[model samples]
Each structure stands twice: as structure tokens, then as C-alpha cells.
Target: MPNHVAVNPRDHKDLRILEERSEGMGDATMCCITFPEEFRNLQNHYTILFQLDQEREAFNCLAMFGLENGENLFLDNGRWDASYVPLAMDIQPFMIGRPSDHDADRKVVIDSDSPRIGKGEGRRIFDDNGIPTAYLESISNKLSHLDGGYRASSEYIDCLKKYDLLEPLSIDVTMKDGAKNRLVGFHVIHEERLNKLSAEGLAELQSKGYLMPSYMALASLSNLSKLIARKEAAAINV
Candidate 1:
């Protein structure tokens, strides 16, 4: 479990966070939450998919990095091989928090127990004068983007649902060694339905600024082949 606390200069002035990408730093996940706003960038390198959040009874967007658990094909030689890392993955050890459900103000919270927490060997969160550092400022921007994106994503999903534009996706992959892998329990934009939508429907989606993201999600499927190639190469090296 994460021990998250509101960040304050008094108690967290010495805090430093490692920014390297590695399995040891909790970057081994196969996917991370993403939003439609990021679809344009994510589609270039990741397969964007929608996953059901059973607890919340809602669907959340995801940027797929690998086919299996604990496998992140984008992590190469201690560096991420993508131009745009999803804000959710980039804002590690930091999150937006509110004092109450109705609170309008948000606070930056840190996961004190995260592996990224460093012993004065990484990016300092604050300077000697108790001011946030440039690294921390960047993180704050990422957190804000993620926080706002999360809320906006819910509305996007609702719009998709209203138009019945989502469908289940099941992918099966065969490795060079004849090993089989199956990706299940995820959804994707229904391209056929989207193509068949009426003009009014299209206009509505366009007016709401969802038309392009819908196409972006569909286009991201092209990266699945790239993902499989990476998996095959990794297997050969191992």
C-alpha cells in the first residue's frame, strides 16, 4: 500500500525522487491509465484501450506498453523508448488530493514509501530555501494534467457509452517460440459503429470535440504489431 501524505516544505524538504525508468522503480506495468487528451501522442507508440473499473463501474482509458503483466516493452536500457510518456506514469510518487469530496482546492501528495523516494541521490523536491525545485514544478504540472484529465475522461467515456461506440477486444499472440498469449477484458472504440454513425451523431461528437479522439483510439491499434515485435525481440535476447 502507498503511504501518501500532503507535501509540505517543513517535513519533505529533503525529499528526492528517482526519475529513471526500470522495473525496480515500479515501471514494469503492462499498461497505465490514460485520457483522450493524450490519445494523439499515445497513438504514436502505444495501443490505447479501455479497461473496465469494476469497483467504480466505469471504463478507464489505458496506454498499453506490453502484452503481459510485469512486462513493459517500452523500457529499454534504463530509459523509456517513447516520446510521450503518459502523465499517469510520469507523475510517479505524486498525486492530487483534496481535503474533502466537495473541496475545490487540490493539494500535491507524495507516496513516501515509493521506491522512487531516494536518499539524496535523485531530483530534489525542494531547494535549500524551502522552495519547490524545477523537477518538482514539472511534476506538479503533470499531476495537474492527470487530475484534470481523469475527470474529463469520465465525461468522454459517458459520451462514448451514450453513442454505443465501445466494444470488447480480445487479442491472441503467438511468439516465435510458439508460446501463446491472450489479452482479454478490455474494450476498444467500435470502428464499424463509428463509421456508420449518422451525420447528426457525427456533428454532435464533433461539437463535443470527441470525433478526433475516437479516430485516434482506433488508429492506436496499429501499434499493436509493433508491441508484438518488441516482445518477440525480447524473447530472442532472453
Candidate 2:
């Protein structure tokens, strides 16, 4: 559970959030939510794939790390050993909330229970004059980007579905202990099908700037081997 309240300068003028990156910051996720806007950065480190949100029946992109839940092989010495961390992971403890009434407004709320919410060598949310600090402004911008990203991602997901490019995927991992791990219920873009699209169809997608990320996601599949190596290394230490 989260204790989220509306942010106000009067009550939270001295709010100093810990700005550190660690598994404790809720970055120890096997898969982090991502959008098409981050494909280039995300592809460099993790495999990008789409998974079905069974409740909403919508397709969403994800940056995969390990084969099982709570198994993020990207963690090294309690630190995220990656050149790039997804925006979704970078902005933690703070989240955008929507109103339930007819008025559609988003509120900025922080998870009170988060370890990041203590006074320390972190970011100061407000200044002496009660104005937002530079760090706080950046967080505000990120929240706005997230809202836009969700809108753009909805369009991107539709684009992939309209062309039937998404294909179901099941990854089988052979662990060092001779145990088998099967990752199922995920989907990836079918490269063959994408390549086989008609000239007109390809032109439409290329015009929309959707083709590049599709290919990038396909390219990222190779990093799964890197994940396997990571898993192996961790197992050796144990």
C-alpha cells in the first residue's frame, strides 16, 4: 500500500528525496514498462518485447532482464549494471495519478513508504522561497513526458497490431544446474512478416516512424544470451 497525498509547499517545503539508484529504489524489476519513445536507449541494454495486459487486453512494451519473476540479472553489487536505465525506472517513488471524477486532471504523488523519501544527500524539492528546485522541475517535466508517452504508446501499440507484426514468444533457458526455465506469454515482432510487408504497407509504417523501433526490438533479442551469461556468473558465485 502507498500513502500518497497531494503535494503542497506548506506541508512539504523541506521535502528532500533521496536521489540514488539501487535495487531498493524499486528498480529490481524483471521487466520494466517502456514506450516507443525509449526504444533506441532501451535496445542498447535490454531486449524490448510486448506483453499482453490481460486485464486491459492491451499490448504494452517492456524491457526484459531475466527469465523469471524477481530475477533481474542486470543487478551487479546492488547496483544496476547498465549503460542505460529506462525512464520508467529512473523516475521512481513519484508517480502520476488521475482523478476519478469527470474532471480529468493528473496529480503528482509520492510513495511515502519508499526508502527514497527521507532527508539525506538527495534532491531538494523546494527552495527557501517555496519555489520548485531545478531537480524538482526535471521531475515535473518527466511526469509530463510520461503522460505524452502513454498517449503515443497507445498509438504505437495499435500500429503494431494493425499490421499483425507481433508474434507470441516462449524462451527456454537451460540453467547451470541442468534446470529448465520456460518464459511464456510474451510476444515479439515477427521480422520475417515485417520484411514481407507490401511496399505500400511498408511505406505507411516507415512514414509513421514505426519501422525502426520494430527492428531495434528484433535486434535486442540477442542480448538474452548476455542475460544467460549473467545468470551463469551469478550462479557460479553462489
Pick by lDDT: which candidate is best?
Answer: 1
User: In candidate 2, which residue pairs clash?
Assistant: none
Model 1: per-residue lDDT, tens digit, 123-214? Answer: 99899999999989998888888888888999899989998999999999998899999999999999999999989889988998899999
lDDT of candidate 2 over 1-238, digit per residue (tens): 8788766688778888875656776666689888877888888789888999999889989999877888778777656789887777777777787778738778777777788887655687888888988987788788878767866887788888888989999888998799788889999999998999989879878898888888889999988888788888888987
Q: Please report, in order, the local distance difference test score of every candidate based on alpha carbons.
A: 0.92, 0.82
TM-score per candidate: 0.97, 0.92
The runs of at least 3 residues in candidate 1 whose Cα sits more than 4 Å from the true structure, single-residue gaps closed, are: none
Where model 2 places Cα greater than 4 Å from the true spot, the runs are 101-105
Q: For candidate 2, report its TM-score.
A: 0.92
lDDT of 2 at 174: 90
* Backbone clashes in model 1, listed as residue pairs: none
How many clashing pairs does model 1 include?
Answer: 0
What's model 2's lDDT at 151? 68
**Local lDDT at 95 for model 1:** 93
